[model samples]
Structures are given as C-alpha cells and as structure tokens.
Target: MKEVILALITGFIVGLVFAGFKLPIPAPPAFAGVAGIIGIYLGFKVMAWAGPMFAEFFK
Candidate 1:
C-alpha cells in the first residue's frame, strides 16, 4: 500500500510537470496501451509462478 501511494504521488507530480512544460503526459493514451501493460504484468506473474516447478524438474 505504501508503494502504491508513492507511485500515485510520483505519477501525479510527473503529469503536472509534463503539462507545465506543454508536453504530453507519459502515460497510455488509449485502452490498447493499458491492456498491453496488463498483459505484460500477467505474463510476468505466470513466469514467476512456473519458475519453482521448472527448477524442480531439472533437479
């Protein structure tokens, strides 16, 4: 929870700084981009879950 709050605050500050400079916010501007991020996260989770199983197989 603390990390999440920190990320939110950091993102908010970056968004403001970008806007102040009249630049685009460095965030996904479309649903597709958001979905791609989600997919990457899910893939990482799956790999972590499978890691121990694969390790045992080789031993």
Candidate 2:
C-alpha cells in the first residue's frame, strides 16, 4: 500500500540522516545497514498502528 511505501521511504531517509549525524556513535557501513533495517522495521510497525488514518487518506 501507499502508506507502507511511504513509511519505507521515510525510514530510509531517516536512516541516511542518522548515518550522516553519527547518532549514538560513529558507525561503519555495516552498522548503517543495521540502522536502516531497524528503521524499516519500526517504520512498518508505526504505519500498521496508523493504518486506519492512512487507509482513509490515501485511498
């Protein structure tokens, strides 16, 4: 769905920002990938929780 796609995109963008800023600590490429994975999982969970609103808006 659109909301899932949007959440994934946003998560990727956030991961990029986190990678750039060195949040928590400086991380290598592998760590950044881990952060991206975490971001994606969290994003999807959040989108699922917000599904009703997104379904109404995006549909």
TM-score (C-alpha) between model 2 and the true structure: 0.46
Model 1: colliding residue pairs: none
lDDT scores of the candidates, listed in order? 0.91, 0.80
* Estimated TM-score for each candidate: 0.76, 0.46
lDDT by residue (tens digit), candidate 2, 1-59: 99999978987888888879877533345777889988999999999999887797877
lDDT of model 2, residue 30? 77
Query: Which parts of model 2 are misplaced by more than 4 Å?
Result: 1-29
* Per-residue error (Å), model 1, residue 55: 5.4
Model 1 misses residue 13 by how many Å?
A: 0.9
Give per-model CA RMSD.
2.6, 10.3
Q: Hey, what RMSD does candidate 1 come out at?
A: 2.6
Model number with the top lDDT: 1
